[model samples]
Target: MNSPVVRLRGLTRSFEQGGVRIDVLRGVDLDINRGEIVALLGPSGSGKSTLLQAVGLLEGGFGGNIAISGTDAETLDASGRTELRRNHMGFVYQFHHLLPDFNAIENVVLPQLVAGRARATAEDRAAELLTALGLAQRLDHRPSQLSGGEQQRVAVARALANRPELVLADEPTGNLDEATSDRVFAEFLSLVRGEGSAALVATHNERLAARMDRVVRLHEGRLQHQGKADA
Candidate 1:
């Protein structure tokens, strides 16, 4: 197998509420290889989002080691972490946080622009991604002008704009209706696989989890690998 796109060891996180200690994650050790899609299964309040935040480098106060694309996250300062995220990671949230001010193609293009990609090249790539996601006709529409599913599709296009090695998504389809969720998720999986990027997607849906390359569940602050594609 290729080198892992993401690796975590002894990863833990805790919070204090009302002078009481709350442990969200407990020594999570995982490896996600290139071109693999791993479903993170858990119920609400089970620390699924917490784990994704830790892996995405969006959380401080996390304990233990996190390596992305082979670079040790512990060694990086804030700016370095930002750079790492910019160049190597893509993120999708439950809500489609597309910029309401920008059109679909422009929303996708902005990230690449931030990463120093040329305007023309970024536009072309954005167009390609949005088109692939079945939004060719909606490219000129703003987020507010589109339907929920359309907005989410644009969000997917934006997440993939940078061509990152690893994609981290948290409840990406949770907001949509069942039919829309299924269709958008299928398109999302196809796009992620086509881009050759590894993904760690957190979701409460078992049917969706079973469709991934592997299924891992978070329970009682620990990770349990349920199985893989062939297993």
Candidate 2:
């Protein structure tokens, strides 16, 4: 296996409210290799999303070492963190956060634009990704006009637009029906694998988690690796 694309050592996350400290993650040690599809599963508030956010650089108040693609994240400043996130990480949430006014293609290209790519170049790459995701015909459709699956597919395409080293998906298919969710998961896995990017998806759905290469349960506060399975 290749060196870890993502590594978390002695990771801890805590939130203080009204002088009370709530621990969300307690010393989480995880390593995700390139091209691996790993799922985080557990009951509500099991620190699944917290772990994702921590590793994805969405949260930084915690203590520990987070290394992505061989760079120690703890040593980076705000701008450095932002740069790493923009250049090496991709994120997909349960809700497709597509802009209401932008069409599918435009939505997918937004990230590339944020990364300083030319509009024409970003659009071209976005179009290609949308085409591969079976959203070619929906290119002109806005978020409101597209179906749930199509919107999520567009989000997936957006996640891949930058060819990120790691993709963090938080209940990405939660809003879709079973069939649609399965299709979306298939497309997501295929896309990540094809691009040799690692993915850590947070999900409550056992069936969906089973489809991943490895199932990891975030129990209490740490990640416990369950065995692999064939979906």
TM-score of each model, in listed order: 0.97, 0.94
Candidate 1 colliding pairs, count: 0
Off by over 4 Å in 2: 229-231
lDDT of 1 by residue, 9-92 (tens): 999999999999999999899999999999998899999999998889997999999999989998999999999999999999
Across 120-193, the per-residue lDDT of candidate 2 in tens digits comes to: 99999999999989988999999999899999999999999999999999999999999999998899888889
lDDT per prediction?
0.93, 0.89
Which 10-residue window in model 1 sums to the lowest lDDT? 222-231
Evaluate model 2: give its lDDT: 0.89
RMSD of 2: 1.7
Output the TM-score of candidate 2: 0.94
How far does residue 141 in candidate 2 sit from its true spot (Å)? 1.2
Q: Which window of 10 residues has the lowest lDDT sum in candidate 2?
A: 222-231
